[model samples]
Target: MPPSRTSAAAQSANFSTISVTFLGTASAQPSSTRNHSSLALCFGGRGDTWLFDCGEATQQRVQKSDVKMGKIRKIFITHTHGDHIFGIAPLLAGCLNGAGGMIDGMVDSRMEPADPKELTTLEIYGPLGTRAFIRSALRLTHTRLDGRYVVHELRFPRDPPGGDYTTLPPHRCELPGKNLLQTPMDDVQWGKGIWNDVYADDLVTVSAAPIEHSVACVGYVVNEQPVPQKMDPSHYLPHIKRNKAPIAYLSRLQRGENITLDDGTELLGVPKRAGRKLVILGDTYDPSPIMPLAVGADLLIHEATNAYLPGIDPATNNDDTEEVVQARTTSRGHSTPQMAGRFARLIGARQLVLNHFSARYRGDDDVNEEAKTVMDAIKGLAEKEFCGEVVCARDFMTLHVSR
Candidate 1:
């Protein structure tokens, strides 16, 4: 016999899923094999999607993938670096045109005009100068987004506030008749002062912290919110019906509130399901500031722009011995593979995904031999350092996050 409706609902509620797609994984510049840095996060239950770091041709990458451009509600820019943010304006323009059915002046004859209420406003969050950068880009391109793009500029605390870092008040662009953008600054306190809650909703909470890099850059952590457990109706429906429980009582029970039936019997609600945590880092030399956020994360997506020399043992080598390589990456404001792995190990991340490879490692002419060697070495180091699964990120790669 088919399962009852309540039983199915209960089973469905037992799991929560999130997926991350690597749209671009190259560093600084696009290579024959990879684009720049971009990724998409999709929530399975709500069908909500977010973009992180829209690099050059990110829209094209999205087009080639299964992601729907119209469904992207938020874009998070890690910094003002061109490779990290150059694609924002074009992507926005494309999204606007696509949603309004103005693609190449070819409109669907039977389609009605898009409802203003149905229009999706894209919220962009980034560091200081984000608004100016976006504004300048739009103005120079003569692209009028019709106030559909809302920008949120995050501010970091002046100096270290004793413990960690903190964010100053964020500047938000207001829309007509409604404020669609909300930040997690209010929800998260100035703990250790290193990280600030940037975005939070019923489904997830996102936090950001500055990392050590050439310019001002930030990394983000996404945490899924605990959902109320589903109660099997078959287990309680008969008792509830026999007791003639009111609709209000049933609603309260579903909400995990204790409810007393007319027969003076009490029903306990099911516990909530545990949520998952994901961390995505920008270009950084030192990831220590956000180490707390990375701790216990289910997935940690970090940049591995450089790799160790083939014969050098990272554990045995001293900083002085590797000064040249260190200077190269640090001067360019990037991280080495060993750095990424060490960070993941320190945090005890369950899974580590390394991306943003430097162009020097690209071996397009030789069928990616040099690149594969670098990636293999990085994976080897990471495997030795971290106890979890390690993966080298490639463009269009997707991973499912489930709990």
Candidate 2:
């Protein structure tokens, strides 16, 4: 049997921490220190891993990091940028073939789940061209999978994938290569600039909104569902003793199941406690459109594509200023550290983790490199705008967000 997935009731009081690990944090291309843009959001409570972008050589990064590829259940792509998505086909092929120690990864079971129509499918969510990109890559490369994949594309009225009309939104019927599911984001599925409830399960509800980027880019907001409240055993203990109730009742109650005692006294489960919300944006100059869902986020992971470190940045000169850096970064549809911080402050995020650093900035693996100093200075820039805990993300760095 598959490893038992923790239910919301079972994980109620566990309130375990969720870990966000940066697999690659480089912008545009790979440097010696950074790969590209990709991160792993691992939920300890659920035993599931979700990847937010799959840049080139991401599988290599996964091999090096503590993250287990076997647990990756879903992947969310920000846009159709090559650097943000080049690793997808290889990762999927590996999972389906169970090669390279990925034996337990989400695989093809052939057997249907509890639901009769259930297909052991890997789900991928992204922008308009995602289905075309994946299908073409998998098809052109002659890469086959034992299992199937479901691609959900957020369609924009103004933006559609150029040169790929066959795989465009309002998806065609499933092709037999292995039954790919392409579901289009319809009018009912969207608002002015937001795609509400892009995905949701027992643990979390994910939403997406358009951000200002050169391409049709969107950002995601993951709001964890409230867990059942901590059990107040004292209240039930008295009644249990008085009624000589079975000890098993306590366990059931802790699981948030209402129990009727021998005396016919009914005990209601404790109220649920609110969970945390996390906002993670893609390459963007401005992300104000998603403010409604992102306000008061517990954690915000924003891109910091360029910085104005005079002594460190290769582009920075004596006459260079943050304003100059901001203009250049925004012109390319990317954010600087200060821009990220300002957005974090607008959302009232408690913690800010900045990612997608330029190639000039080094990564954390080399302690002797300028990464330590450059990252600290970058974090300071964001901290100036957002009065929260600011962090400069490095490849393989993990941040734990407590429930």
Candidate 3:
């Protein structure tokens, strides 16, 4: 078990290893065991985190767990639905206001003020207009945050030089303006490559692809780089036998170097082993577009709200007595348990973690069983196709992605 309280960097070693905590997993409404819908994906070594969604109770979840809210450098809002992003305003405030803010006042969390010169801006990435929504909410609430923040709109037809161009099948270069003038464009290209990232000394890359959903919802693929495997001390045994200076040189050698000493002595070409890879998807009903991108991900965190109620029609069936909920789920655009599992198996994730549940299912027992049922169902179906580990995620749960 991971320590209850620990620094983000201290939580794990490799960037290939990820700590994913589900704050809320319910659809639309809040439940005792599950809140709305939110997840924190902590990429180890990188010290950078990505939030899949921010539900209303997300702040409470962060306060109760070891996750550092201030460390959440990036957030991706899947859609504008209330359940997905209702908690963002408060979450941002909790980090910005330090000890006097929402969570600070509630949980007594502290912030060791950093020098102004060293502060890095918090980046919020989401669908088009998400920034506007957050700005409006902050303005209306009269909430003030101390840190610097910038919102980048993940809009369609991304800025030129990052968009698509078609070519003729005859291997001829088709000019952008003339090709579409006479013919209908059948193939539409999506995605603006993987997002290049650098957080402190850590590096990460993100890619986005359009998924089938009711509205304009896209799924994100997070590829985290793990810390380089620990250097074998035995490799530098001779250096330790020499002197302290040689040992210091070994440290540099482990950092991928061909070391040359002041006296012309050299330890040439010491190559460290490569690190692990972790892949995560925000939310997707269809698994096709994201498969290649998610290929060979050591760990894959996908939505599980739909995983429990396998084959149970969300349209005609809901445990809630209210009839509106049954119709709301599909109309509002959310996946079911079986749907989530199917996608995971299709994508070929080495391990599948399911999160984001419906409010109708409450209590740890019921949710766990529901999740088990879905995983079992998927396992039964996938036995002939694919074999991988599947898990039902709970709040504050940590797993070793690279272990």
Candidate 4:
């Protein structure tokens, strides 16, 4: 269990500050108001930006938002669909080419220009065909990245056999791209389903699991390390004032470290708080396979491409029943608001955020006479099933995940 908290980041507060920005929310086709599918999750005090799916016009969206392109360190691709990955090559190309072949000229998450010699390599993770798709696009377009990028390919039982131009085991050796790595995701060494430790840093960890979609798709679960509980000054301040003890004792206590004052005052360390977890999935008809990874997530970002609530929707079509609408959406390997809500309930998520909306239902920048009614119906459907907070995500919306 997480300890109670408030607004305070003591010196020991190296806690992950996870902020999620919906860069693009449109589904297969982008409307004038909404772009394609893309999400930016910024973590840590440095504001390291990690992207989930990069569609066409994503560069434009990033330029218009607060997300710094140079701060992008890792990109996690869901699948090889054009709409989900078209912007990768272009975005990476800009990062490498814009700085005269030196990425260090780019600003970091801290908004400070990195040292000229600090050339941290970029990483990209995705399903099987991701390597081929990106390699082909970059190679054919003659877009050479003077900097380094490693592509980590994931393998599933459903994936086809590996070969030339295929990202498979025993990868063909090539001149390492500027001493960068190119390899496959580690095998499923222990688990029956989940791919544990997909990616990890000092601040957080990411795990991957397969989701049911038309093509091979994977969902990611981000889990932050438990943060030290906030120190209750009332518990010690009065005592300190009475005793004239050193202030450094409080600092150590905040980090869950036991401390003893000069006069022999003993203070027990505060217990750590449970960290926040986020489960983000691509377009999917079902995602039961990720139950273990997603269950009890703090936030679940699921695709709700369509929704039809008989009494709430602004639909005039007499034949468009909830069943009909759901069938249509599921046929395309997508989910309705209620489906997303049901999954959220099954996973025991605390809150639900719905994205990857179809162009017809609009909000934020894209609004029509029926937009509010349609979007409300979508949220209503999800709330009806999940019994939790349901947000219909719009482009450029920012959400901070708190412990």
Q: What is the TM-score of each predicted model, taking all chains together?
A: 0.78, 0.83, 0.68, 0.79
* CA error at residue 329 for candidate 1, angstroms: 2.4
Better of 3 and 4 by TM-score: 4
TM-score of 1: 0.78
Model 2 poorest 10 in a row by lDDT = 171-180
lDDT of 2 by residue, 226-255 (tens): 767767788889999999888778877775
Better of 1 and 2 by TM-score: 2
Cα lDDT tens digits, model 3, 1-403, are: 1001124543444454566777776666787776777778776555666687888878888888878877887777776678788888888877666222223223221322346445445666666556656766665554545665565545554333322222211101111111001111233442333332212223445655555555545566665444354677776656545544556766666655676555455665455453444555555555455555666666766654443233642433445532344244445455554455556666666776766655555536434776455445533433333467766665666666564
Clash totals in order: 6, 0, 8, 0
Best by TM-score: 2
Off by over 4 Å in 4: 1-12, 98-117, 160-192, 233-250, 258-267, 309-318, 365-369
Residues 79-188 of candidate 1 have per-residue lDDT tens digits of 88999999987898777662332233343432233565554567788876666677666644444443356776655654222211223221121232111122233324
Kindly indicate the candidate among 1 and 3 with the higher TM-score: 1
Q: Which tens-of-lDDT digit does each residue in 57-84 have in candidate 4?
A: 8888899999998889788999888889
Clashes of 1: 6
Ranked by lDDT, the better of candidates 1 and 2 is: 2
Task: Give every collision pair in model 3.
Answer: 14-227, 15-226, 15-227, 16-226, 25-357, 306-336, 306-337, 307-337
